[model samples]
Target chain A: MERERICFTLNNSPVEIHCHPGERLVDVLREQLDLTGTKEGCGQGECGACTVLLDGRAVNSCLVLIGQVAERSVLTIEGLAAGGKLDPLQTAFVTEGAVQCGYCTPGMIISAKALLMEKQNPTEAEIKEAIAGNLCRCTGYIKIIKAVQTAASARLEG
Target chain B: MQDQVVGSSPVKVDAKDKATGATKYPGDLRVPGMLYGKLLYSPSAHAKIIGIGLADAWQVPGVRAVLTANDVPGHNGHGVIIPHQPVMARDLVRSVNDVLVAVAAETMAAAEEALRKVKIELVELPAVFDATAAMAEGAPLVHPEGNILSHHKIRRGDMAEGWARAAAVVENTYRTQMVDHAFLQTEAALAEIDDGGILVLHVATQYPHWDRKELSRALGMPEDMIRVVGGSVGGAFGGREDMSLQVQAALLAMHTGRPVKIVCTREESFHAHSKRHAMVMHYRTGATGEGRLTAVEATIIGDTGAYASWGTNVLRKAAVHATGPYIVPNVKVDAYAVYTNNPFAGAMRGFGAAQPAVAYEGQMDEVARVLGLHPFAVRWQNAMTEGCITATGQVLESGVGLRATMEKAGSLVGWDVSKING
Candidate 1:
């Protein structure tokens, strides 16, 4: 197995790291770049805990190999906030009590962010569909859905 | 005594860290000179171990050490109530998930690869998969003490007289399948010898103090020599209450004199951890024409699987709560925790009350139908009130709210307007 040097924009910063082609993008980000915010719930893509935005699209980093993300811009939960300010979705989640055990919070927020990016005001069904991949075992999806709706409404008002 | 913070929604202290991914779970931990550990589970469900060849595994590159049942310095068994389960299968493999070998190496891949080189010879034995079949006359014994792990019974008044006084009787059998906790994070543990020569294990578990005591017993070390620290658990719906990889990682770290980390894959988590006991319950209830409960008899059999984890306690709970919250003068309840070759059964959210609730509630509905009375009305008539004596001989001096709760539910659901039969 040979290690390949790859360059990519991580959390809006250009970085280069050597990784095995067989390694998963989630492993590369966590082990190599020290971006441990992205969790690997299920190594299989069934769980969306390892969700990261690649080229403005939400993707399961566990399913994506290191070679697949070769020069793409990746955005993780760590990158959602900037200048010591919480993202609207993060703030809404905190206020709405959507972060129960908090294991699924990062993935849920990332999915909600992608949804908000695509549509300013998504319907409840659309919001549910967007985050259907992420599973939160603690709080039954009601609180999470409410949090996303709150963030969407806040975005519309602001 | 409603305080400001009692009913108010306050943010969790760790919510920010967990949401920001700053909270480190056991799997995310790493130490300098750390070695990855992997275990080789038995392939056979029930078998006798003929021999295990570890020469090829020892020759694997980057393999630090290999351990089997022989390597356990002290007690080989660990269980919550009964210490019968082996840390590693000593002579016979009772279940498919029984661990046989553990390997430590530089990388997880190398450790897994080394596990592949280890060969184990097994002689297959007849396996019992059902609790009733396992308890029958000459079935295969899962344990030397026989298939019945623990049997609990509660006898109050005369069941025969109570049934004779009733006008209608309802009997049914209900069953529930085994359930996994399915917590977000799987089992993981990291162990290292600290500067003070104490083995410190950071693990995802429900009980850190219990893990320390069990680890001390398993490794034959003083309680002070072992320090168990529970990290921010991803989720533990009672599955993490039992020991999984805690002692194994500690043993490997002690053997190699380096930090050892072990994380269970989802499949491994399902195969290895304790699950909710599957229950088969038979219930027969006698009700008068007025819909008042006369007597109830329940026989519950819980499949505790390969080893008794919390079977004894669970069976007792099932027996005690078999009658639900109803006031029955003549009640007979028998609960048995039976062993089989299935996955080990232990604590879950409901403990053992969920299965019996289903049976008793279903019987209540049947009794209501037979007497041509509304379900809520029948339940309200028989619901325990203040000063009512329970089948276990406990008098309810206060907090008898079953009838009130049922009436409130009926009103909230518009039970009077809705079709009651459906």
Candidate 2:
């Protein structure tokens, strides 16, 4: 395999790495960059556990090749919080008791961040629609929906 | 301090870590000079292994070590309750998930390449698929000990007495399908020698102490020699209660003298771990004209697959709970865990109790239909109260809140709990 160097802005910071063109972004993030926030529940991309924002749009990091992300800014769970302060969505998830096994939290928060970036005050149906791809076996999705709504309301108040 | 926390909602200890992606699951762990491990599984559910060729796999440049059944230094199997499941199948392969070979290499790519190079020869054998069919006299034996892994029964009161007092009866059979835990994080583990030269195993498992016992038995090492660090588990339900990637990774780590990490793909995760028992339950529930349950007789046949992972505990629990939360005077429950050539069933969300609910509850609905009583009314009538004895002879002494729950549910849906006097 031909080794290629890819450059991308991560969490508003520019970063570069040398990897194979077809290597999964999830692997590059976890194994190479040492950013373990993006979880890989299903490598097939069916499960949204490895979701990350590719230019502010949530995409399955496991499906996106490292080379495909060249010159684009990517956002992960680690990048959501700013200036050592907890993001509203992260605070909401913690307070709402939405993080159960915590394996799906990173992806869940990233997906929510992508939605709130576009829509400030998303309806419950809109929140549900955004997180439809993300599956949480715990909490029955009730507390999760509530958390998303709570975060959206926080954004509206701010 | 303990008393203060008892009645209050305590924030989960790991919730913050989980929300921030700070917890490191076994798959996310990284150590310098770590090798990746890969496993080769049997192609057929039931087969006789003719040969396993490791020559070509060992020839791979980045390959560290390729191990087969013969390389296992101690006992080959790794089951917790019954050590019948072979970590590496030698002569017989009872299930398709059975591991035939394990390879350790510098890169996961190399490990995958090595696994592709290793060849296995097998002759397919006749396999029984279900629990009931496997119990027949002429059925192919999944194990030499016979197809019945375990049989649990709760014989309470006389069957004649139970059948005689019945005003209305419901008899029907219920079948439950096999279910996977589908935990967000697939099975992953890293095995390496610490500074003290002891094996330290990092894994996402429900029970680390149990892992110690089984790993000791399989590795032929003392329990102290093995150290298991609990990785931040994503979601187990009941899937991580058994050994999956612990043994093979440890073996490779010990042999190659390197930190060996093995992370299963989604497909491999489905195969490597145990599943929930797919049960076949036949229920005959009898009740009086006033909706008081007289008796409940059930025969539960759980398809435990190839080996008895947690079959004994599962079937016994199923037998104990066959009558549900109702009060029945006379009850008989016979639950069997039978061996089949499908995926081995271990622990799940409900163990084995969930399957019988489909039957007993259906029977309750049918009994209510025949007696022309409201279903909730019938449930309220037969609900287990304080001081009531269970079918398994356990007396409900205190905190028997079945009726209290029904009262709240009754109010929620506008059911008149006080007005329903049968």
Candidate 3:
């Protein structure tokens, strides 16, 4: 119930907020910093809709409290694009028709970003296993998988 | 043939915003002086409302308004087709998800705490859950009307002659359970009285016109006075076809003179919307030794649950498609939808037509096994042609492509029809 000043690096920018330490990172990002790209599908952490990068590692923002995010680097869907250009994963999703309703797009792209960061050439099964935490009802995950493959191939051929 | 988009996939207009998370869903949007709204649901499945003590809820510091069924400004009920569902349980609670009271507070915590302060008394009643049993004599009435919500039947050709020509008869019973759509995002809505005193609603829904119509009924306002706007929905798949908290949020906003938003948690979302209907189907399909021409009889019972959302239309389609895409000279189908104390069932992927494939198609496989004929051979023999008449007595005059599709599927699956059937 106590409110205090919380500091963290958000989207490559240093930010500070005065809020309860136990508040969820997803809530803090959306309500405090106005980073609404971090979605909250299931608050219980079962769904990866609130996925964000914590020090370059994908984590569900809903599960991490503001206290855990203190002094840590976080990246959200809004930050995935740089210099007004969409990330390759996002572009691949658009071209592959991987989006429907799009609630899971942010988390899917974030997880894919984390995967491609770790391995430039991940196998198809590894790509599926990487995004296994993120659930998508539409697209049946076929388009999403294809989008990831397309993005990886584009990176390889670029 | 001269079209640019017919043979190619085009980028969706909303895809960029959706991927970037720039698209604001109902929950993401906020206005000045907005309050969080929460509703108190029934604990018992069926009960008689004794009293609603709301004084304690109003005593909360930030709680602006605590409303019960009696506080509704206009009509108290809302439903997709029938206006029989009580927005807030007035005299009776029909299901476990029935709303008893609503609270509006500056913060979600305050609203939740205010919800705990409201007191409701109820007398639990007998309940029915099974469709077939609910139709029996002396069953507890879920509604004032009888348990049977709708009955659809199909009868064509002579059963005696068709049965006499059959060499193999397959009879079996199949049942499907209630299935949830489980879209990634739950239900959320925001309602506010705009500058012009018109209520502007932002919601995740499949149909905004229906929302406007139902809101008009619940708020006692003219249709023109309401403006419904669609939000960035996660997924609907028929789940957003009915009202969740559209009326409750509007009423709270109307009373508090501020914007009101209600977001249903995953638990509440499961109970809020109608799911795919659970069906019990019985089919008696007969075919000759050559896997051609006979009679098909089917009886399907669908449990519509607490309210009839789209049960009538669903069961009708079930009966119409009970025989599947095959041609049977004589056909008989009796499909019934019934009311029960369970959660309501409505539109999903198939409405009611998808479940019967287990029965008729199962019968097809059984005939194939009994006659030692290839599965494709049996289906190919009974495939409906252009002039075939459906069980509902509708004749397909043109563009009936069942035979053509079967040929394509057969070749794709390496089914050689020349050596198997002929």
TM-score of chain B of each: 0.97, 0.97, 0.96
Instruction: Give one digit per residue, the lDDT tens place, for model 1 in B292-389.
Output: 88999999999999999998898899999999898999999989999999989999988998889999999999998988888877787788999999
Query: Could you give candidate 1's per-residue lDDT for residues A112-149 as a string of tens digits?
Result: 99999999999999999999999887855898899899
DockQ scores of the candidates: 0.70, 0.81, 0.81
- The digit string of per-residue lDDT tens for model 3 on B1-422 reads 43786788888889888888898999888889999999888888888989989988899989999998888888988888787778898999888768899999999999999999888889989989899999999998999889999999899999998899999888889999999888888889999999999999999999999999999998899999999998788898888898888999999999999999998888878878888999999888889998885999999999998888889999998998898998888998999999998888888988888999888888899889988888888998888888888777789999988888887777888878667668
Best by lDDT: 2
lDDT of each: 0.88, 0.90, 0.89
DockQ of candidate 1?
A: 0.70
Residue B95, candidate 3: how far off, in angstroms?
1.1
lDDT of residue B119 for candidate 1: 89
Candidate 3, A155: how far from true, in Å? 1.7
Model 2 error, position B227 (Å) = 0.9
The residue-by-residue lDDT of candidate 2 on B1-422, one tens digit each, is 56786677666788888888888999999899999999988889999999998899999989998998887878888786888788789999999779999999999999999999988899999999989999999999999889998898898888778788889888999999999999989999999999898999999999999999888888889999999999788789999998898999999999999999999998899989899999999999888888888888899999999989999899999999999999888988899999999999999998888988888889989998999998989998888998989998998999998888889988899877788644
